[model samples]
Target chain A: MVSTSILPLQLDNVSFEVRGVRLIKDMSLSFPAGPRTAIIGPNGAGKSLFLRLCHGLLKPTSGVISWATTEDLNPSDAQAMVFQRPVMLRRSVAANIDYALKLRRIERSERIHRIDQVLGRAGLHRLKSQPARTLSFGEQQKLALARAWALKPQILFLDEPTASLDPAATHAVEEIIDAIHAEGAHIILTTHDLGQARRLSDEVIFLHRGRMLERTPSPEFFTQPRNDLAQAFVRGELLWWNLGKDNRKNKLKQSN
Target chain B: MNEFSKAVAVAFQLVLGLDHQLIEIVSLSLQISVLAVIIAAFIGLPLGAAIALFRFPGRMAIVVFFNAFMGLPPVVVGLITYLLLSRSGTLGTLGLLFTPTAMIIAQVILVTPIIAALTRQLIEDLWIEYEDQLRSLGAGPGRAITALLWDGRFSLTTAILAGFGRASAEVGAVMIVGGNIDHVTRVMTTAIALEVSKGDLALALGLGIVLLTLSVSVNGAAFLINETARRRQS
Candidate 1:
């Protein structure tokens, strides 16, 4: 396996526009491997779009993304992403993991072994025969993580894996994510949970309204954010003028 | 008054006696319709998937044409087939102007678009939900379409059976192109028309019952399949 670490990732002047509205502006950054980097920002901060660009799901109108690779990138097999909502196939839990394994042409016995390993790791082995959609919301998120874990990608991009899960499920998912990182997979995740960022992230990429505000180490970012937008966002202050006090109090629990 | 009573009484006898001709027509109609549906599915499903997954010039026009084709007048299609296969027409050399094959061709043309367009609509709606996830998973264009089509098999089955139901019940195109030749191209729908015209209510009504039964079966099967899909999706 070639190390995605060798060259890391470079995005130069990356921009994405939809119907004359810029979603991601002249953004340029290099994402080095081997860190649990959390991307955080306001609702429309283009954090999700930036993650999509990193996953090669979106093409920039005018920028370049280059990877440093020791050997061939294969590009196809080197990455996996779990969307905010688990994008489940209309299949059984076991079949879902098998489908991912089949993509790389793993032998059937090895595929079965891998499925058992990941499902047990995520504590979903008991529900392996059940249809994936039948699982509770939290369980589905766990299965999604298990599916991605089974892929063993060089880069795992997760867009808010715990956004909609319950507390126990969230804790369980975080543990699995930590376990995956321990096995040496670099993780790039996006979230609005400040506490989660504080707990898991090695670095933070602070974005606001389609532009990078600040990219700093996690401890430094939480203690003293340099960008006004990042600072306000960290304190649960209003980014948009219309945010009512009640809505903020209800939805904005400072994470970590 | 007497004629009406006779018709009704004979209709009962036809039901009780298992009339061979009426049964033959009903069975043949099922055979042709089933075969046509199978063939149409083989062709229409992939064609619909291709149209939805790929972009090229004239794609909109093709979709528009298929949508329009869903409501095509059976008589007009019959007339076109008649003209093409009639003596001194373009295809007169084959001498298939009034045959079961001609009837199958006409029904195939009438129903293929219905199957294709319905499949296209089902896939198009699902694509809205799955497209982003699929692209992000590095599912190239071909694999994405294949996955979507396979995922949507339940709805596709309904579309195909709908086409089959329409093909079996349709009369005008088969009547004209098949010439309703006795013991040959005669199918349930055309035979129904013939027997009704000749005051042979017994056979016509018996065949009509079989046709109704088939329609009911198709609807029941579709409901079951749909329920299964719903359970899985939920």
Candidate 2:
């Protein structure tokens, strides 16, 4: 939302490990400004781990993740993140936005204006004075997005922002994410929901077993995956350890 | 049974009539204990929060030290304070011993570690839930501690009350340092101890009743506040 942007985020052979088990293995990718990107993978695919490393919430065990930084700006100042389960401060809905803004060191009057503007846009104006934690699950997620929206972050990292929502709530959240994207902020999110990836992303990065198997435009990637594992994933066939489970179940069904 | 009933009668009359002597003891007790809890919170909450937030070479040892000191015997604290304030001792020139100031100092010393240790625990739990979001928002260590303390304020109130509980119920430290001088440093706990030693059963029972009521009232307030917070949080 500013004249200058922290775009073209580059990751060069980055790998993350914990307790001797690698979660994100030797991933090197470049994310330019414009199109929304979704990292799609099954459970334990290290999608969230990759997102966290890029967000600077965790350090890579090896290699480098860097942003195009300006001399005057801290990389953190230009980005914000919304977790799967949003954390609400024990305060009013308005104050939650205010707190994030205050941390950004925005002036008093600007904070008030931003809080007012964001809550109004997010349909949270009616709940402005209500305690944030008391909000229902769907409403809490929306509030989380609104809080991040108030920051006017140049890049928003959403870690499965809609993973735990009902249909109506998911629709609303997708709309909000699109709205944020339309406002010229770069979007990077991780989702296991294939339909969500198809609907929300311009490009898809398929991850399997801590590795990037493919990166392609959303439609072409879904239609023709280059990797054999990715093709099986696109075909809705279980692969890896899950393939063994699927085979046993099929064999038992045949016997029965 | 007859004597017990008579004691109960004396306690009720003293409480309902708001006896001047009882009021003096209750007022002085509130003054010293409340002041002690306030000062302790200022020092202890930050100390606990810092310990919870930062990592150093001997961090675990410092944490264990404070946890052990939460149960520090009041007599030991009293003796140490007495020595420090004695005429020939290092801080003796200030001449604080045997005064209400000395009693307040003793209570502060007794209460701070209780507050610090409890706050360390509360803030540590909160930090786990908040670390990712806080770091993503660009908050450094100092900001994280402040934000966490504010969020955990509801539970921390009880921790502070625990500190107040120690301060108000303690007699040994205040007794040694204050000398229990009437119209000067006599508080409810020390007065109760004195009247019991003198075999003034009626007055002792009366003061004991007042102290119990005060304790229950503070705890009740803390409960009500937490209940309200829970409702709002849900």
Candidate 3:
């Protein structure tokens, strides 16, 4: 079977607003196949909202988001997503993987084969029958990745996949991510971890205050970001959040 | 106080002996209520899930309608069913009135709103949690409903049991529809009601005890299932 890619997706003047507050300002962006891209931004910078818009979980309030696809294409078969806090079905690991495959209407034998293959690849075959929610947080994230892989999507979107993970868990998740990228899927993810951004992405999109300020190659963006906010972010000089800490300390002293 | 002790003593003896009439009443009670609940679940679960997962015109109104009807007076429902099944009424020719089938029908009406209303509230909350993930997985509204119900099975079991409790405890509906016919349509609640009026305090007390045991045992089983599922983190 020949697979046609739905890449080179274009968004023109795309803006998303929640109750009159524009979370994603007028943005024109194109996502071409091949490169592993990462969206880097600070807290409240709208990275997750941007990801949701692209993943079609939220519709843009204005402007256009279009996919350049072949005549007969199934959007579901072409893309998948893994949320930051993994959502494990109230079922076994094997069954969770099977459910995604079943939604794509994969045949039973093939679904079983894929379930076994993905579970073994994640080194979770031993706990395949165990309820997924019973697994540790890291294991659940891995199962989320494994389940998405079983779908064999051409594009995978991740929203802060390792944000809450410990170092070891984050490492495991990053490894699975690399494995997915190696299998020829387009990887688009968001993270505030600058080191992880540098390691995983070929291109970096720096966003600040709900606006895309810079798009540059990994090496150049890290060395000398063009925008002032992006530059300050790279230098770790945006530490104004310490005011809250100082205020709390002063309150404690006054109480004493 | 002495009279009360004598009543309790006679009740226990009758229970241990399993009087023929008592057995028949208890068995019929279980049969009607269990069957009614089964039918109610089959309709209520998917209906409730649909209301939770989909949005349409007047959806909130329908939700409010179900919630309000959950407290629907059993006596009113019995009177309505009595009318529909009575001769010259809508379903009159079926001759179902005064039969066990009529009682089952009335109980189904009484139990369905309870099950549906509770399932809707439970599933609506779960949908908020699973919506984004399921949508990303390409599940449409239809599939989402089934997935939510399956995942919420342990909690939904409690809702089903609540309906069963209501069905088994209420007397007005079955008494009206079943006519409390001696052996043919008599159930524990209806029999107890009849026995009390006839001054057979011992039998009424006995059936009351049996009914309480059934309610507690069923609810306890549901609680254990939920507790186990919670520990297993499902």
DockQ of 1: 0.51
Over A1-256, each residue of candidate 2 has an lDDT whose tens digit, in order, gives: 4436677899999999999999999999999988999998788999999999999999999999999877677778888899999999888999999999999999999999999998888889999999999898999999999999999988899999998899999999998899988888889999878889899999999998899989999999889888766776776766344666467467445543
lDDT, model 1, position A193 = 93
Model 1 scores a TM of 0.91
Candidate 3 lDDT at A188 equals: 94
Distance from true position, residue B226, model 1, in Å? 3.3
DockQ for each numbered candidate: 0.51, 0.79, 0.67
CA RMSD (A), model 3: 4.8
Of candidate 2 chain B, the 10-residue stretch with the lowest lDDT total is B225-234
Superposition TM-score, candidate 3 onto the true structure: 0.95
Give the docking tier of candidate 3. Answer: medium
| Cα lDDT listed for each candidate | 0.83, 0.90, 0.89
The most accurate candidate by DockQ is 2
What interface RMSD does candidate 1 have?
Answer: 2.0
Looking at model 1 chain A, report the run of 10 residues with the lowest lDDT sum: A247-256
Per-residue CA lDDT of candidate 1, range A1-256, in tens?
5464433778899999998899999999887768789999878889889888878888888789777755744655777888889877788899988877776667999989999999999999999999888899899988988988888877788899899788898899999889988988788899989999998899999887788889999999999988765776887876452466565444444432
Model 2 spans > 4 angstroms off: A1-3, A239-256
**Reference-based TM-score of each model:** 0.91, 0.95, 0.95
